[model samples]
Target: MMASRILMQRVCCVLVRDLRGSSSYSSSLTASATVQPFLSRTVLRSSCRSVSFNVQDHDDFTERVINSQLPVLIDFHAQWCGPCKILGPRLEKAIAKQKGRIAMAKVDIDEHTDLAIEYGVSAVPTVIAMRGGDVIDQFVGIKDEDQLDSFVEQLIGQ
Candidate 1:
């Protein structure tokens, strides 16, 4: 019964995406060039009015990410991993760019193995975007700012 229900849920998600169509999703994601990424972290951290990005404990991923009132983007990462190191700060930068629009958090797989296993996060930089306890989207591997912008924009449909 549980397996069937889970399968149904997956089907529904796919159906929704197909029905909505990918082009619409893409267009809304990059509607304008308003989301330009900062060229350097130092300048970004220095110049613009700083937007708040909080680093939370691993145990708090569910409380902060899945159940969030605002759309939450979570970077499931580990400390020893090289790609994770590169992606972690990049994820932070992305969050800061659209600070008010999105809530961002991360889970350290080494510290919190359960979240990593539960989410099936086998890779270093698996970013899952969630809203109201449902996963809305995900991005794997290295993503440049424009890609990040579009990925995030897909989650933030008007």
Candidate 2:
């Protein structure tokens, strides 16, 4: 029953995305009803993951990434980019393997254009590793799990 409810909610989310421009109050209400559980589950997972998060704004980025005690990995990506979608989960898995040795900040380039420009991110799926508020290393493109692990290991070892 819960599985079906979740599936139903997923379908609603897709519908909402497609109908975002439409001014339908009923659609909005249906989405609100269906999305609560999905949002709750997402929040629970994010909290449990602990080391991964989405960047909110410039101030948030400065506070979380620049001022972080641990090394931070910044993932600059976009929703419309296919490679960004593929790299995101793989990067999360790689970050998880670190056991909190490092942290990840997911920055949507479209939302945070300033940050992307400041970081010189001309492409999607750019991963930058920073320590002591300084960029230590960066790469632009998709990397295999092994490569990601190696990158994280290097960052942590620094």
Give the TM-score (vs. native) of candidate 2: 0.71
TM-scores for all predictions: 0.61, 0.71
Residue 78 accuracy (lDDT) in model 1 = 74
lDDT of 1 by residue, 1-158 (tens): 63464345445445445635865744653563542232122232342322223335543555556667788787877778888788777777777777577777767777777777888898888888888888878877888877888887778773
Q: Candidate 1 versus the native: TM-score?
A: 0.61
Deviation in Å, model 2, residue 69 alpha carbon? 0.4
| Candidate 2: segments with Cα more than 4 A from true spot | 1-49
Q: What is the lDDT of residue 131 in candidate 1?
A: 81
Tens digit of lDDT per residue, candidate 2, span 16-117?
Answer: 455565787446646686655654555323443368878888997998899999999999999999999999999999998889889999999999999999
- Candidate 1: stretches off by over 4 Å: 1-59
